[model samples]
Target: MGGRGAEICCASIPRVWYPGMMVLVRWDMPDGLKHIVKEKMVEVEKYDETGSIYIHFFPNDEVRVVVSIYPGYSTAHPIRHYGKPENINP
Candidate 1:
């Protein structure tokens, strides 16, 4: 969302059906320092909830990223309720 900021990079997974839900994220560190983390795994807690997805990054693990995409919505779509990018620690 809005030019890559300090968060980790992400890409959406298409085809696979995940119930519409908001991913919640929590890192061992705060937001700004999250980039330095290497390997990480996103423990998918629940499905269909609005919030941040918690993540723990491995020291040597490359940052794992996930981006959400709304197919019907155009790229110009406003990131409010749909199609917002999020970072997964691992």
Candidate 2:
């Protein structure tokens, strides 16, 4: 999913994470979070850091999600775990 200036760096990952590349979208949130973004465009990238969902782009054009959290907080869904791939699921 590159436009111009960037290129996909991730090559591949376990197929079990996502046996089939799926485009998952949930339209409703209790109160729609205006902060959740597709790309890393956070305002306070350091302290007031927010949560993020990273989809690794494989060479075959497939992907898996990777969530990262900083010290602060975010409006996105509260996840159970992060930095541990064994617990994450598609």
Candidate 3:
């Protein structure tokens, strides 16, 4: 997800259509690069007429964890999106 700011919106979508589904891990950057996961079989939609699913995750020590969604499907892999620990604001 890298265009729309629908982080909370995407995460809130129910898993009804995606039953027994799991998130998938696409690639993880090394050498202190940010961790990026690629989710499959997810229904991504733009917010209103000027929004899209653009998600960006920060380092663990930088900000809270978040789940983002993008519009796409896996061709040769299983349909599952990645999952990360969310942070609790105190």
Candidate 4:
């Protein structure tokens, strides 16, 4: 399955977690958008001090963010897990 910016099905998306470093984020799309965004890479637009991480999908440019009560924690439905390849404990 694929979406606007997606060339093929993918379970993960590359994300810049630190300067010069990239990680992958595994997520689940809302049921309504799954057909439109199947396995597409979710692009992170920015982050804020409130533990909110902003994100968007390519071509569509619709922005979403994960708000959290604790640092490094997310309460957003679109996000499932994020980490390096070898240590994705979430």
lDDT of each: 0.33, 0.32, 0.31, 0.34
Clashes of each: 16, 0, 13, 0
Off by over 4 Å in 3: 1-25, 32-50, 61-90
Ranking by TM-score: 2, 4, 1, 3
How do the predictions measure up, each by TM-score? 0.21, 0.24, 0.21, 0.23
Please write out the lDDT profile of model 3 over residues 1-90, one tens digit for every residue. Answer: 222223233334333333343333233344456665543332332122222223344344222222223232322112123444332222
Please, what are the lDDT tens digits per residue for candidate 2 over residues 1-90?
A: 332222334444332333233334222113465543332222211212233444433333333454345211232422222342233222
Better of 2 and 3 by TM-score: 2
Residue 62 of model 3, lDDT score: 22
Which residue ranges in model 4 land beyond 4 Å of their true spot?
A: 1-17, 25-50, 60-90
Model 4 C-alpha lDDT per residue in residues 1-90, reported as the tens digit of each score: 123332224323234333333333444556764533344334343333243342333333433333232333333323433332111122
lDDT of model 1, residue 18: 63
Candidate 1 clash total?
Answer: 16
Sort the predicted structures by lDDT, highest score first. Answer: 4, 1, 2, 3
**How does candidate 2 fare on TM-score?**
0.24
lDDT of 3: 0.31
In model 2, what are the clashing residue pairs, if there are any? none
